[model samples]
Target: MGNDGSGAGDGTKATEDAESTQVYRTFRRARDLLLTHREDYAAAREEFAWPEFAEFNWALDWFDRIAAEERNAGRPALWIVEEDGADNRWTFSELSARSNQVANWLRGLGVRRGDRLILMLGNQVELWETILACMKLGAVIIPASTLLAPADLRDRVERGAARHVVVRDADTATFADVAGDYTRIAVGERVPGWESFADARTAEATFSPDGVTRADDELLLYFTSGTTAKPKLVRHTHISYPVGHLSTMYWIGLEPGDVHLNISSPGWAKHAWSNVFAPWNAEATVFLYNYGRFDAAGLMEQMDRCGITSFCAPPTVWRMLIQADLTALRNPPRKVVGAGEPLNPEVIDQVERAWGVTIRDGFGQTETSVQIANTPGQPVKPGSMGRAVPGFTVALVDPVTGQPASEGEICLDLRSRPVGLMTGYAGDDERTEAAFADGYYHTGDVGTIDDDGYITYVGRTDDVFKASDYRISPFELESVLLEHDAVAEAAVVPAPDEIRLSVPKAYVVLADGYQPDAATAESILAFARKNLAPYKRIRRIEFADLPKTISGKIRRVELRGRENTKGDSRATTEFREEDFPSLRG
Candidate 1:
């Protein structure tokens, strides 16, 4: 009896520890390889191996390995909290057991391998439960942010060919408009036509695998942010994301037992990129805090309290975070990274001054993982997104000449395809073929590379404009505009010009407590003219809100359209390079 009792206690403790510490160690092997080969991107891209598993389920294989090895060894697998102070922390082992229950329960409800399930929920426990359970059951997950409107839901249901939906109780009404013959399971109080997710807790904790999981099976279908055209359906294989975020693991500098908090919406690719895959790849704890509006101080407080070791946020969030007292938190994370868009150098400088830590920037999209990053333990070049990440072969292809150039559209070599590349845009073969033309996976975004191979921010090929025969990048002008004291935000777009064909027109949003007047305008225009070349000067100005897409990208296309039609609006202030003789000189 004593021996048996001791064994039970040890087993119990082992489960807890495995749930906490094991994931980090397992993720470290690949992280070590990434760091060691950071400088040798070509070799790493050629030689890197995706961890081979014959009977692999990332949740079962990698996560279970941690459980068997680590005994209460580290921390919880996931930690979430609300602004009101409600919180939940689940260990890896606990999550594993809970997921088993969810999987079994969902299976009983008729979920099967290859079944498409639309998971629409907020930052709640059901989201994680459904994610793991679906993974174990081999159900394809179409993650949806609760932010989607009912109309958007209909589009997703039809486009995804969904067979099941696991959603919040209140959100069930959304399906009233989105009709489908699908299994509807709701969390919280049971709604009519929806099964209660609460029942899953009663099922058996021990889950048995019904079949083998192929690494190449479709796991995630992303409805990308439609900046221009309709949202493209992006298909990600199990290994493509689960195993492919190894590059993201390297970019964020995640190590064993690190606590990583990535600021992103639940349904977006960036969320899965960090919260699920990258952290799990590094065995880092995924930390999340739910809030109504962004509170930079609150985020820093959470960072301090949680001892968050790594952080990643979009450039938009970083811009907001920098506006706050960045030094208030005495201890910042060991690593900080910016994504979504190229970061302005002004934001990086402020953070470095306050935190004594440089903010690293990286480049990638919904179509791929981290391709370029100013990584940990490396020198950061302001305005330059560092070298290409390990395992990605990047080339700058001149569109005009159809050859590699110092400045051109960034393309990935298809001959040496990285595991991080997407399978293709779902059901869009022609578009996919066009994307992979000329033995390269063209990224569409244009940038420049120096002799040393460091890539710098240039506007998108479509976004760049010519002013007096001098090409101007809106990002470049916008960066300079941000440095001025009167400017909170700025968007530079081409306005119609009778002589120069096109001249730089800047729409400025004044910083807090600044008045919009001729003085402020002259200050901004003078600052731009002084810093920029004569032809690249900001010739026209407007004080107005910048238009943005739903996903928060500046709609330069909209601004350009306005210039074409409403160029005569009295709101616009036109200045000529000749009007300012000093600028002409």
Candidate 2:
């Protein structure tokens, strides 16, 4: 995306002025309040306001304001570096203009309002440009990570009603089998049938919207992980993600012009939640380090060199980050966060010691933005995921009675109706009704809220097992296992048993000094039994790394499938709870 925001004055002056009067004033106040209470969660939630607007296009309206104003005029909107050392950075001004050019180009190529487009590309400048251009066009975007297989592509094309496709030249082969009436355009070199993206740079830099995007227009389509079934199509509207991510902006505590680098793949909802909308909404520069393989050392160097003010990664990256020397980087970012799942305290502690900053944890799903998080400047409970974001009202309902409880399924009240929520799962009305039943939108995951209003994530509703007729939260067990010297990481799943019906079995990874043998397993089991309730104690242990999804979440479904094949198939280093004689009583 490359042009002149001043050329021909495509966007009417009166419209721009009106946006400045009302919408921008509110944004300024919200942003001000977020910075003022960056450290206080309760204060921020109580005080923050979602910007009120009759009509808005974040790329056209808000981003343009920031560039014209002093706050983000010359600040980098996107900063990129390749492994080979070539790099370029786009200030907010440059990015906004470039997006106009791309928007004009895409319109010329038949991309229009409400038309669905599948965006698949690596971490390149065009990716960001296309995002802004699409937003300006009011088109629905389905973000696809380049890692997707042909099957995944076919699924998206069919399910999402894709009218256009924008992909990298390298990834064109994956689309060979995907049959659709969509326009094909590729970013790098010329593909046989696809139009060249290289033409976008030559297009005029100014673009005027055919009409103002309705705040409720469908903006994004996402395919969920679909563990028990096929991936569900999730839909988000104009204000749903763009404006609703004020919670995410506050959760990460990014300020205007701050360099924020969030490690996530391109296609996932989490990527858009943080990488595209949230950081840019905060007026923060999105810094990316493109690498083939994860290099913890190289990442740290980029952070230091670029002065990344805020950083975020999922538990998978955090797990690997701890394995590397934590203190290798000279300067660590001030604000850091972990998402995609609840992070272990060990990783948090290790990073704190090395960086002098605590790693805040956030929890949300594909259907919503960050609902629960440990906000900046808040008193973070050891394992708690902080508090509900500004626009969300969280309720932990009793699973049996649906009454408010300290620990239960994490649910959002439908009464207040936060904008961040999806328009319900696309094309599955029955499942959608179930998800939003009982005046609440139920998140399948379970969590506990304290008297101070902090919420701690428990395991998923199905993943939390019952052992010896006592409900045992797997996260509680996993937390205890992580405390053991020999334990690296663990996942507890129900293993079928003859007497108990099902028992808690841990799949674990050993720390550096330990091995997967009877002695190591016994020691860890002893440690768990000593630390846990008698009924909640882990009855079986397997010394092996936990299996996870591509996004790094523990695949309990896979483990559950393995247990189904056989009544109880033990791994090479399996140890029964009864193996240790210390608890014969």
Highest lDDT against the true fold, candidate: 2
Global lDDT of each model? 0.81, 0.83
lDDT of each residue in 1-585, candidate 1, tens digit only: 110112345766466445324433444566567657755555665566655433345666566556445653446889998899887888877887888899999999999989999998887777888888888888899988787888888878898899999888888887888888899999989898789999999999977656657767788888887676677888887677877788898888877688899998888888889998888767678999999999999999988988989898987788778777888897898788888888989988988888888889988888888888887777777799988877778999999998999999999988768778888888889888888898999898989998877899798888998888888899999999888877777889999888888889998877777877766776788899888877788887888887875666788888888888975555635444454545455
Model 2 C-alpha lDDT per residue in residues 107-188, reported as the tens digit of each score? 9999988999999988888988999999988899998988888888888999888999999999998899889889999999
Clashes of 2: 3
lDDT of 2: 0.83
Give me candidate 2's TM-score against the actual structure: 0.94
- Over 4 Å off in model 2, which ranges? 1-21, 511-514, 578-585
Candidate 1 has a TM-score of: 0.90
